[model samples]
Target: MVQRHGDEQSHVMEREPLLSGTAQPDSDYHACHSISEEDTGNGVLKPVPEEDEEQSIGRGETESVKDNAHVNVLKIISVMLLGIFVAQCDGSILMATHAIIASEFNALKDSSWLIISFSLAGAATQTLYGKLSDIYGRKRMVIIAYTMFMVGCAIVGVGQTMWQVVLGRIVSGAGASGMSALVSVLITDLLPLREVAQWRAYVNLVATLGRSIGGPLGGWLADVIGWRWSFLGQVPPITLAIILCSAYLPSHTSTVDEQDAAATDLLKKSKFSRIDFKGAFLFAALVLAVLLPIELGGVSIPWSHPLIFTLLGASAILFALFVAVEKRQAEPILPLDIFHSKDAILSFFILGFQTAAQLGMMFSVPLYFQVTSNPRPSATVAGAHLVPAVVGNAIGGIISGSVIKRSGRYKSLVIWAVTCSSIGYLLLMLRWHGNTNWFESLYIFPGGFGMGVASSALFISLQMVIDPAHMAPAVSFMYLMQTVWMTIGLPAANAIMQTVLRRKLGVRLLELGYDSAEVAKIISDAVSDVDFIDGATEKVRNAVVKSYIDGLWWSHAFSFSCSIIALVLAVFLKQRRLDGHKSKP
Candidate 1:
């Protein structure tokens, strides 16, 4: 027989022996086929059964359970996700609770800062957690994240001043950065490829649900109890999550035993046989330095402030050094090799665009209702409206998973996901002009369906391209990007709308030939008041209200365009659906 005997993973099989003494080219294949036939009397070749297949499957299942460091990883994920929900909810949650928190603190004039502080801090630190988890371990880093959150929660609960609460909110957001990508990392590490997408989709469903509902729940809780309890309420859920995760989470694959074992095995190689502190340090500094500017830009400080410039310049220098160190390090944290992979880079931008668009919707749609006279529902209704989206997310993910398993291809499903979602985004963002019942119903469900399908497709495609060893780091990379972009995306969209609205209103007033300063004063006065009595403000009032509506309409158009970019990227993907032990190379 000519088949390779030592390796079981080879895709090719060889035959033997009929040509051993003869000159026949196919004789060796015949000989091997005969031997196989003799071993398997019916001419079938398969692993010999020492036990029934079901019993064998059960025994192997137990061994797998023992091998996994944590038995209740899923439960921990559930708890961790709950924590993620609350923190993420806090970012936009302020939209609903803005008046309440501001009333309690006596800072009604500056309530917007509550939302901004949390969002900025959360965006800046997400990527930092990815590298930290890679260095220490997911389990340890998660604990750190919760501790930070708990600290923030305590600060907010005991606050006597608005700044103290801002500090608390900032701390809570930093902690959220850790939870952002860690869940998906653990999912892939703990499960088989066949199961990764469906399970990841479930986790994503939790994230989306928490994101949508967390705010309203915070609002209702504050109303029923007090605003301070909103921060205090988070502690119990986080405390429980820590206990469950510590008891269940295994040491990362970078553990000494796994590393040693990898050295002996060919298929499993350690990506971190030796640490590269230089690259890691530079990487963290680089991430922090660059993000500080983007996060604080136009909000707390001028964009050209010395502090911002110093931070951004330092970030640039560190990025250069980090790349240099990664090139030389035997075991690198950045894993430069991954950047060269087609799907890896594409997935990054694809995810970046996707998240940016999502963040804009989450922020803008809620604001639309909160500020408007009559809309679909109140801003508080975001929680209930999103329930359908959650169902859609889970369903789309499951359907995508099934399609891959049954058909062994991904491009078609990916294409459909992109197309449907692009149209859905358009419908949701469109100017329906008038309030028709059919118009409302038409957009919401279709948008949810498209979003759900695309969410699943993203997981499948990402997991397919990633190196098995850096699975956690890879997931972290993506999650960090999404959160960062999401934070920036919202502010950028809002900033654009605000600027455009001001310019348009100013132009209309200018055409009437009113003194520029007088026109500015009139518009400013209208915006300051909460009341909207038509005759009181009259012509000036309509201009302000019309400006807001027009700005929102154009903002929707911008978000829809971003979705189109993602749809285009989906077209270039080469499908790979992993089943059994063989994933596409």
Candidate 2:
């Protein structure tokens, strides 16, 4: 039972005993289990006559409608997933064409911005999307997201300058961020917590497949037409998704009762005024201050640069200010009490560490295949190598969802999944030798499978621990956790690779008697151009390949370390049974 205490919600649950031949009560609903024996107008229970069973018959009608509603909800979920799949496709398409785009601009330095711009923009506005969606309706926000994304894509498709491309990506990323966060939130809104696992699994499977195939498709399109077509082609499907959103997506008011409409309207009017804009700005500044330096330091500038230190210091002060502001806000953008549970805190770290490991492997594994292939594989071939991992990811999500749906337990499953992922990362570390055969790519499947299961299960677990009303913001926070970890993970892994590769190549090239300036140029060129080996002499190519292989080993080692930390954290996660009630303790 749910009782409203001013603005806060309090829940009390008491399970009732079942009698023989009694109707089973819905776990989530609060309706009386059945007509009481006393209410039946007799001391002893007796079956009602077919002619006088209006109450029981009415109950049956309500249940039948509910069952049909669930089927309709599934249809809506499928449409929402179309948007997510396209978003993933857009990202992978960009990844595949990143190098080509850089060469067009004649500025390798600008390439990082293509990704960084998107990520930073996404991070900055993630909380805003959550807060705003709560104030406005979800369907309205979703339509706005699609509109913004489509506009951004059009800008990118026509972009002739580097700045224009960067601007478009930032706009696009902000919209995509909303699509990602709101899809999960909307799912929870439409379905019960227990059924979420199965539906989310289906959505996640589409996302994995879209990302996996997008790279190869992008490469093929870029080759046949041009890189610009990659952006243009995706617009059609996004348009279709927008159309679907308009026709079927429900507003928040759909869930409200007719009698409560006036109260809801009053609440809606006040929600916007109560928004913590100051908290939002401070949070965004904090993210940018820390992440920008991490992205730049040790790549374009030294790690010890005064600018990096300044940004780090500024970020600390901003964080302190953010907390102070949030504590006093009438309605904080991100509530302070959300993390009061130890499970929430621990889950964030486990997600962070696991994401770090997953991203490291995602990047380094592809590099290993590209650099070490004897004749050097095409972008298409390198993309194909990732298929096993994607397939494994899809399978894992399906299996995890099925398990969760059947048993309504997640903690043990999460622990085992993370442990399995750690072992998978270990196997990846062992299998990714410099010269690999076709079979070597299969090694990533285990790691991918574990990651897929763990990621989906972790989301379900996090949802179980938080209030249903807070689901959108909590899920958005989780997405932010992923973005933060990914931003740190990819760059950190690249830094390790660059540092290792430069040192190893320099030492080996000097031994081969190459001039210092020439060696430096070669190393720079190799890092900039993905296909630098194609232009180098046989001896130089072989040395560079060896250096790349060595660098990847160190990167994978970093991934292994992250996985170990995640494994330790996973073991401590407390398992709670899904009984459709929030525990205040």
The C-alpha TM-scores of every prediction are 0.77, 0.85
Point out the worst 10-residue segment of candidate 2 by lDDT: 16-25
In order, what lDDT does every prediction score? 0.60, 0.74
RMSD of 1: 10.1
Candidate no. 2 TM-score:
0.85
Q: Clashes in each model (backbone N, CA, C under 3 Å)?
A: 2, 0
Return the lDDT, model 1, position 210: 66
All-Cα superposition RMSD per candidate:
10.1, 7.9
Candidate 1 lDDT, 356-457, residue by residue in tens: 666565555544543454433544553344455446656777777666656656667767865765676677656433342433634544445655666566
Q: Name every residue pair that clashes in candidate 2.
A: none
